[model samples]
Target: MSNKTNYSYVGMAFIILVFGIIFVPRIVDRIKNQDITRNDRMSQGQDNNFKDNSKLIFLEINGEAKKVPDFSFTDQNGKTITNKDYLGKVYVVEFFFTTCPSICPKMNKNLVDIQDAFKGNTEFGVASFSINPAHDTTEVLKEYESQHGITNPNWHLLTGKKEDIYKLSNEGFNLYTAQDDEVEGGFEHSGNFALIDKNGFIRSRVLNGNPVIYYNGIISEAEKTDEDGQEEQISMLKEDIKKLLNE
Candidate 1:
């Protein structure tokens, strides 16, 4: 090739290399930044979905959400406990008798774990109603509390009229409680724990009355798989409490 043509080719190659050096990294950086932004948006969307799902109101009927019915009962300390006390507080509710030999022990143990998880948080608490109110008097509940080592001020073991307690269990908490001779522990009641929000509305329960229910104040499913479900529900319950507190 001629010298003039060779020099022209070399000059063109040099100019192209200069342009690539200047623009290639900027192009790559722009693409990288766009990918990061897209990922962030996707992550934010997933987080929003989780928050939305977690905040869904439970026990809705006829387009209206169900809330804890206003009632009065006596706690283990013989104090008048009512719905007013739980106003603006997030708490868990369960139905059990002190003498229960089957599920009540497990339920109470789980509750102790929950109490420990939110040990100092005033906004979180537990309300355990006795289905066997005829026998589960204030003194009896106090003994049960002592046996279980529940020293949290937020925990309340309550006893009240049998009719009132039964109605509250079935109609209010969406839990079953009845005296059955055939059932173990002389009572047939739901073993599930319920989550009530600050407004006294039940936010967690057996969805659609399904038997395969989730318990409030228990660890998450992932933790359950690893730890054989020990304290897993309490971890999930703590997460739910944080969500409500944030809201």
Candidate 2:
């Protein structure tokens, strides 16, 4: 071959190599970013669908979604509190009596942690219903709140008629609560905490006709290791709250 032709061939090969080095990585990175974005979109869509399809049923309504029953009670500060007061807000619901020496304290501590986690967010609140209204009057609940250092304005300790409280606990929240003379605390109540949506529907319990299951707080069995049980519940509760808030 002529020297000029050999030089031309070498120059062409060098130019092709330079172009490949400059553009190949950019092309690959562009494709990678596109894949990442598409995967993210698909993941988000699945998340939305999961949230939308997961329905919390009010057990009293034949496994249908229904609003929580209206209730009127007095808070620790002598203020009349009712379901109307928490309209348009997400809240955690629990059943307890002030004098109980069993799981009530642990449940309250967990609730305290939850309260601190969402502090200053007006969209969230906590409500504790006294199972023994006769003894857990507004003044008694006030003392209990003070003893526990519960200073959150959004946390309300409620006291009302015993019948009303029991009905609300059993029929409304779908929890077990009764005056059991045989029990240590003179009352039998579930330790589970319930998450209620802004629209007043119990969002933490699922009804499957056989029985309703609560999502968080104390459970009959730990789904994970004992050490991680409460932690996992808190984490799941936090995620569920975020989902409801976003929805």
Candidate 3:
């Protein structure tokens, strides 16, 4: 009986060693190649398919999808640019001034972060229209861009007629912008970023089955919310931007 028990132990050890020798290396190789899956996330092939089926909605007006109006402006490099220039790019539009010392800083900081996320993608761009164009001339905007570490070649710090800027803000985009002496900043504008698709139509994520319209740019996603209890939507904006890019 003792001899039989010893033989059984030896057989079990041999079987275990054989299994390790035959399969352990292949298991390790699969892990090294990241070929293992835990049944939680989508597979690599489904990622693009997921983006294509996103629930992003376009802002509609008068039973038609609203499109960004035409406007011409000069960029920080003193080059002529128009809405047509952004036809094939997924872009974010914002109204701001170089001299703004309040929310504009926070808004642009978030935008710079977004630019960093898609560093090499020419399909992405930003249109920063200066509400204080008279003061935010090409030189001033160029200086501001440098000061803020703006490095994206596609980002256009635009300045044109102040009225045209205001018209685009108030009527075209419906994002408020005006000169207000009562405000901390001499000029007041929305601390919001408008996402546009490659076709120049405004795009947004659905909230309560309706378009969210604009993303709050004043708060950082890190903080979640501000001192005044305003929650940040920059994170959602980034996701929706990716969705639009995919579309």
Residue lDDT tens for model 2, 54-76: 54433233334557789999999
Write model 3 residue lDDT over 1-247, tens digit each, in one string: 6999999999999999897555544433332233212221111111111123455665555345679999999999999999999999999999999878888888899999999988999999999999998899999999999999799988999999989999998888777788988878788777778889999998755443233566777778788767856566777777887888877
Clashing pairs in model 3, backbone N/Cα/C closer than 3 A: none
lDDT by residue (tens digit), candidate 1, 169-235: 7767556678999877888877667777888876642222121123532233344522432333455
What TM-score, over all chains together, does every model reach? 0.68, 0.68, 0.77
- TM-score of model 1 (CA atoms): 0.68
| Model 2 alpha-carbon drift over 4 Å, by segment | 1-64, 204-213, 219-224, 227-232
The global Cα lDDT (0 to 1) of model 3 is 0.77
- At residue 143, give the lDDT of candidate 2: 91
Candidate 2 clash pair list: none
**Cα error, candidate 2, residue 155 (Å):** 1.3
Which lDDT values do the candidates have, in the order given?
Answer: 0.67, 0.67, 0.77
Clashes of each: 7, 0, 0
lDDT (C-alpha) at residue 18 in model 2: 91
Per lDDT, the best of the predicted structures is 3
